[model samples]
Target: MGELEQKFAAAFLTEGRWILYFKGLGVTLGIAVLAAILGVIFGTVLGIMKLSFREDGKKTLWNILATAYVDVIRGTPSVLQLLIMWFIVFATWNNGVAVASISFGLNSAAYVSEIVRGGILAVDVGQMEAGRSLGLSKAMTMRYIILPQALKNMVPPLGNEFITLLKETAIVGYVSLTDLTRAANQIASRTYEAFMPLIGTAVIYFVVIKILTLLLGVLERRLRESDQR
Candidate 1:
């Protein structure tokens, strides 16, 4: 076999090393999916808080707090945030996957909040006023009327955020988790050939992300079609 073929074999086909990639991919997806869900949930609340203001056009305490949270998370590097979360915030926790998910989720939430805030604002202000005129509570209007309209605006950016989160989870290795990137690194350490393992890992990531992007495109089309009807 040629050197490249030998390296490929050693990196993957030999000794069932492919299982490592599979397992690591699972972890990577787990963290990304869980983190995306968590980020959306918390980020929505943060976005709402940020939008809260007094009738006098002054910011509420909730707005200040939410803004501070978003600011702090956005200001720091994600790797440093991950390290802090893993080593300090979750020091006693042995479940690196869960910790990493929470860490990345919190990080993603900062950006997601801005996306959500923008989506909510993109919704026509008259929608809220109309709901209120119909005797709907503000909360009910936000839930059934405003949020549904805003969701279409949110989906595209939210997909981007999820993709970014997926890539960022590569640093979960800092927490001792053998995610896809770390799995490739380990395989390369043993195989003594960086090209095959590293490039293979990159290829896997690209393929997965491309699939996600296609899915998002489909969803956007469906939303557009629904609106046209």
Candidate 2:
């Protein structure tokens, strides 16, 4: 037991290991944030396209294309999608961070689109009719009236998506991006002690995720209060 404790301490308590964890945490958070932002923007456009209707109430070409994209992405596993993005589409790009960001962002967009689409659909059609009756163009009505209410409905799902994306970033290390999991793997390799490094990494992830959950809970409460007002 004494020897085991010493080995564990040496593996993680050493000066440089904490820095590795910090750097990995930074990379993971950076990729997740950039991907979430991009995903939200791209997904919003796709959702809007999916919701678009012609004067005759027929679906537009854009809606068909968006549907196909969402189907393809949602039907596939994200890890496989990430692998293809890294190994094939962006094969010429050597930057792992950029590749990971783009891959995750694109993958996330599909699900986010569905979430947004559902939220938009939940709004009453009468709302759109009212806006149009007020002389608001379709675009203006969607932008100002529909989207605001839809977004409030979307908040909880978006929060879950963000959390899922953050955890999914663990696989980014497969592309040689040294995120938290990869950092732990490296430490384990050097120390030849798997438990300490891996457990520490798990603890870090749990703490970070807990913090995010708390923050999201607060935001959800605020949104609910606003709705009541």
Model 2 scores a TM of 0.93
Q: How far does residue 171 in candidate 2 sit from its true spot (Å)?
A: 0.5
Model 1, runs deviating above 4 Å = none
Whole-model Cα lDDT per candidate?
0.94, 0.91
Over 39-87, each residue of candidate 2 has an lDDT whose tens digit, in order, gives 9999988988898778999999999999999999999988898899999
Give the lDDT of residue 128 in candidate 2: 96
RMSD over all Cα atoms, model 1: 1.4
TM per candidate:
0.96, 0.93
